[model samples]
Target: MNFEEIKSDENNYLMHTYGRFNAALVSGKGAKAVDVNGKEYIDFTSGIGVNSLGYCDDGWVKAVTEQAGKIQHMSNLYYSPVQIETAKKLCELSGADKVLFCNSGAEANECAIKIARKYSFDKYGDGRNKILTLVNSFHGRTVTTLAATGQEVFHNFFFPFTEGFVYAQANDTDDFKAHIDESVCAVLIELIQGEGGVVPLEPEFVKTVADVCAEKDILLMVDEVQTGVSRTGQFLCCQNYGIKPNVITLAKGLAGGLPIGACLCSKELANVFTPGTHGTTFGGNPIACAAALEVLNRVSTDEFLNEVRQKGKYIIEKLSTFPNVKKTRSAGMLIGILTEKDNAKEVAAKCVERGLLVLTAKNLIRLLPPLTITYEEIDKGLEILKSVMEE
Candidate 1:
């Protein structure tokens, strides 16, 4: 369909949740997308980090296509070899004892919350269900996860959100300690607050939190929804910090653009979730697992992960030199560019007009490009961003 036709249909049929860009993308390949009007864009957003291998990666496409031809989906009751394979690979890469599949980041976080609560309840028995999350952290959009999110903006419009969540100031040890108590079951944190302007937590503060969780037996749940699957130069961001969280939640780039969420836990909490405690019908779809397996195999390598780190450094260096750039923050490929001028949104719009796709988080321009994006594509996107910033 044409751009106008697509926009008209979306306006008439779809819910108006997204403040979408003017262009309507129809197809893409290897970090380049073409809109319905035949204008091409250098994709720096990567579908908000979902397209890990970029659009239509040959191996990922083949895996998903082949799996679909055989069995696209099966009930959780049935044994799925593909799911088992994906789980095993994830465990091997993450050092987690076991994993439970879900359909989105919110579900994964929900599962993590449930596991922490149950683990505490089995021993302490109720009243110890409060989960402490860092202020300025963004968990997910679901009502429960929204409650877990530390930002006050999302808390509005969602009435009577799930309770037992307390917010602590990020990078403040005293604030985090003050929020902790005998009633707190877990401390859920995103090492890098992705939606909170791509801020990385202080290393010392993170270590202190991990130590406290370990000493108190409070489950340390790391939400890796936007930071997992080698997006952070390591298999998991926690690995970069040399800390092993009790529970870790993953989504976004896990299935290489397909929808999938996984809640992985250590051996101590592995069996906390019984068969009947939680489940999803489409949680471990064969096709999604196949895609995830391909993604894991390709990205969970020293060479691939090292390349991601190098590319991130390269981009940050280039961005730092740009005249309009004030500063840049990143963890692997997840980057936030703060411009000297207060026109991040306007600059992003100008970028779109110049055939570039980018994203904004608050006043900063965010970039979550595909891990497989080439140096040439990076240079092209950076050029567009620089020109727009100059304007």
Candidate 2:
């Protein structure tokens, strides 16, 4: 169907939750996508960083398709070899004792929350369930995860959101300590605040937080949903800070472009959830697990990770020279460009109209190009972006 027809159908049938882009992507491969009108675009957004291997990666497709043909899905009652293999590889990569599969970042975070609370309750008893998150952080859209998010804007319209969440200023060790108390069971953070304008927390502050959490026995949970699986040139962003979190939640690039979320826990919290305590019917679906395995196999290598870091430096350096850019903040492929005009939304729209797809976070132009995006693709996308900025 044409773009207009597809849009009309969507407006008529679907809920208007997302502020979607004007382009209607019909097909894509690698970093290039064609809209319904047959206009091609350089996909800098990568479906919000879910396409770690770019669109239609051959190995990912083969793994997913082969597994789908064999056994698409089985109940949690049955053991899945693919799921177990995926979990084992993930544990090896992240240094986690165990993993729990889910379907989205929100679910993974929910599982993390449960693990933290359960660990605290099992040891310290009840009333120690409060979690402290940094200000301006974005967790997820679920009622519970929304509560955990430290941004006040998300707190509205939810109506009496889940309780037991407290906010601390990002990078402010004193504020973090002030927000914590005997009731706090865990501290959740994103090493690089992607949605919060690609802001990387101060390494010293993070180290201090980790130290304090350790001293107080409060579980430290790092939300790697957007930064894990080599998106930030590391298997886990916490590795860059030289700290190991007790709980780590991963999604987005975990399964190439498929739906998958994993919550990895330290050995102490590994058995916190009993068989009946938590479960999801479709969490460890064979097809998603196969795709995740393929992603881990290719993206976890030192060669690939080094390339990601180099590409990130190159991109940041290039974008920094642009006349319209005021500054740039990034970790690997996750980039935020502060436009001189301070019109991120307008700049993003112009890029989309000119055959480049980017994202906007708060007031900055965010870029989450696929990990497999080529140098040529990067140049093409940046050329379009540069041209738009020149206007």
Candidate 3:
């Protein structure tokens, strides 16, 4: 019933995978959350970017609840109307031909890897299975994605990880070119390196990479797990670069608060997975798809996207007044606050104590406020962050 009692049960039942803040949240609406002790806090972490529409959005709740009453889940063996409509909307929005639904970012990326390797094999007849990813990239926590990840720190304790993944320097055309060979089937990239400190790639480098992929016929797979679903002020961050990728992986914000991921590819690679080639039982469940449809409807509008950009600018502008803030880097709502002296982890803990929810990416304090966050909530959260910096 209270904070202390809930945390006691949580510690006993939950795995110790995360270094949690002291605060325990209970209820929330929009960008505001209250703990069991009735303490309110501004939510800027957005459940690590999963809560795009914020906590229990009315439209999202209605969609999900209605779908739940009708059908919670159906196997892929059965046809689902909501799934079909959501897939159609995704194709229209991204210009991708088809979609394969999964449960999380890692599963979507795993599907992409399968498509790339199998496409190469089907076309060139085998041995071209390597995937090249940029350095400092974070793919996922799965065994295969962990191997595909470029950070060496993640490579340990997992003996005999998946083979055929190579790392290249980010934004370095020469380094990527040197690593690309006849065996390399695809080059997976993140437009804004979210987990690696919100680093955006150079425009010229992106253009050159696009050109190289076009010439070499290597599939350019863009990982939009954290930046997609209008989190970057665009339906897809690749739109900003004006480049068409062969495949795109999406998750995090797609289904508002529900678990859903989509791996969409061009028509050329759409047929790579025939029946029984790859699938999930819970993939494309009607309830999750219905929830995603609402999220997509709200986020995929020009006016709403513009508001995201404006609010992002507003948050950054307010943060500029903090003396300890060295710099703020962001594309839209996803932000990284570089501080002068404080450790991001410590500052984030203090933020929770001051009644705010924040996140950390490497040494930078990351902020992924709800895309539908009100200006009043933004001010509240930023004020808490400012006071933490001042202290």
* Every model's TM-score: 0.99, 0.99, 0.98
lDDT of each: 0.94, 0.93, 0.92
- Give the runs in model 1 whose Cα sits over 4 Å from its true position: none
Model 2's lDDT to the true fold? 0.93
Looking at model 2, the pairs that clash are none
> What digit string (tens of lDDT, one per residue) describes model 2 on residues 134-250?
999989999999999999989999789999999999999999989989999999999989999999999999989999999999999999999999998998899999999999999
Using lDDT as the yardstick, the better of models 2 and 3 is 2
Pairs clashing within candidate 3: none
| Per-candidate clash tally | 0, 0, 0
At residue 352, candidate 3 shows an lDDT of 87
Across residues 15-83, which tens digit of lDDT does each residue of candidate 3 receive? 988777777777899988888788989999899998999999999999999999999987899889999
Worst 10 residues of 1 by lDDT: 320-329
lDDT digits (tens) for residues 33-141 of candidate 1: 9988899999999999899999999999999999999998879999999999999999999999999999999999999999999999998996999999999999998
